[model samples]
Target: MVDRPNKPSAIAPAASAPQPTVDIADDNSSITATLPSGENVTVLLHGATVTSWKSGPGAEKKENLWVSEKAVLDGSKPVRGGIPLVFPIFGAPPANHATSKLPQHGFARNLRWEYLGKSTSESTTSGDAGTGPTDNSVKLDFGLYSANLTDEQQDQWPYDFGLVYSVTLSRDTLQTMLNVRNEGQLGFDFQMLLHTYFRIGDIGSTAITGLSGVTYTDKVLNATEHAQAENAVRIAGETDRVYKRIPQSTTSIVEGDKPRFDVVRDNLPDTVVWNPFKEKAAAMADFAPDGDYVHMVCVEAGYVSDWVRLEPGDTWEGGQRLRSLL
Candidate 1:
């Protein structure tokens, strides 16, 4: 884990104006958002992937997100940690689809995105300061269209589509939203997810709750179906599970007896809980040192169990909100 200093707060008044400002350098490919509350969220255009979200009070500041120490930042490959957006396909693409030629999680996380616009309380009714903690919300939008696709990329999928992804930062929570619009004359099927990697002081001391009785496909067990018998799921080794039909409630990765963070989802019916453990972590060059799994956990939210179908001129939306409760 990268050593980070705790700031006093991530919520406050936007400097100079009420509207939140988006910062991006032409020479640099990364985007940095500074909210009024001293909270900061950084993202890279290469993948439209959120790389860092830091916000909390003094002395006990918290870094809710996590990234691998050895993860490459030069855009050669997908960064191993933080929140990587997955689209078009989840695991391996089906051999029948044109998207099959793409990468494991499709090209959404590997392709660059164009910045749209930002919104804050000053410019909209959504963000109103002093309206409780939620008043500090700030939003940034990034778009990717099929016209920007490379020759090889077009050959891979060939579907004309427009995707606008948004990252909203507030006090303790960082919210993600994806809007998919079909621009082609034909319909297309796709899968999507926000692969979120959370920082854990100790994975051994952490357990997840709010998934009891849910049915899931155990990827580690060769796609066998099973019910979650335990109220709180704990990790002892390599775990790759795809939970289906998840409700729009709160799920959390608790540390010891207390909940450390919360993952709230909407329009997303799938939850992917994974940890590569020791052996797999050592095998991946992107994963730093050894035993890197001991410090992180992934509780992804998406619509992956069944393909989402979108007709021409239609749009679909999905979202996930991450908050640190500790």
Candidate 2:
């Protein structure tokens, strides 16, 4: 579905900047704020359920997607943690735990997104521009577009693309842009993940600084016996890995005891740092069932196996930028 570049029929509203409504009880559980020019953000939803994900002033309550907002992508449970946007493919389901059909990180996190409103935009140089749209926050535009895929998502993804997810809260940064549009013509190839579940107050004195030389995929050494960690692999036991290529101008520091989460990315290469920690989080029953594991930490932004090919008219934009330093 990625053939978008022609939206200019009417999206005006950026003069003095007055569009900050964050009161939700119903009315589609609304939210669209902006703080302009320099940027500070806000975006909360309840209908399609995004539920307040702020940024800047030290990015608060951040849950980019993960865990069950409604729980859509099959593989039995899959959502659990936070920052889950694993499109097309991300993990699990070929491990015999495979239900022959669903249950794994698929289904774009259990389908139900449809806010589709709010504006103040800009994008050119072929694409990517902001401070042009406003709900306010220096610049704003919180969009969501999905075409309706259920039936267990056509018996497990047949083919029919067009998933545009835009969460632009501005200033100091909180950008998550993903536009995959290939309206079922015939050019499919997937693999994408944002999976970010970062909250960490202390993971044994956290220290994931910029991922030194990057080259990982050690699912715990591909399941025992082939260990390989050249650098920055510090999370203390039971840390399932999957890092490759990664270096879009790095930065993934996470100091302990509160206030320090700088996971930055841009046109990512691949980075995932999981933590099932105690008996795979008690044999997963919606994970963290009660363990809580120090707070949270998933640091992901992938494109697995070099999968990113959408050419049916084409439109594939990737993102990841969570800058909160305190």
Write candidate 1's Cα lDDT for 198-282 as tens digits: 9888989999998999999999999999999999999999999999997646789999988888999988998999999999999
Q: What's the count of clashing pairs in each model shown?
A: 5, 35
CA-lDDT, candidates in order? 0.86, 0.57
Q: TM-score, each model?
A: 0.89, 0.31
- Residue 5 lDDT in model 1? 86
Name the runs in model 1 displaced over 4 angstroms. 1-21, 122-134
Superposed Cα RMSD, model 1: 10.0
Listed per candidate, the RMSD to the true structure in angstroms reads: 10.0, 19.7
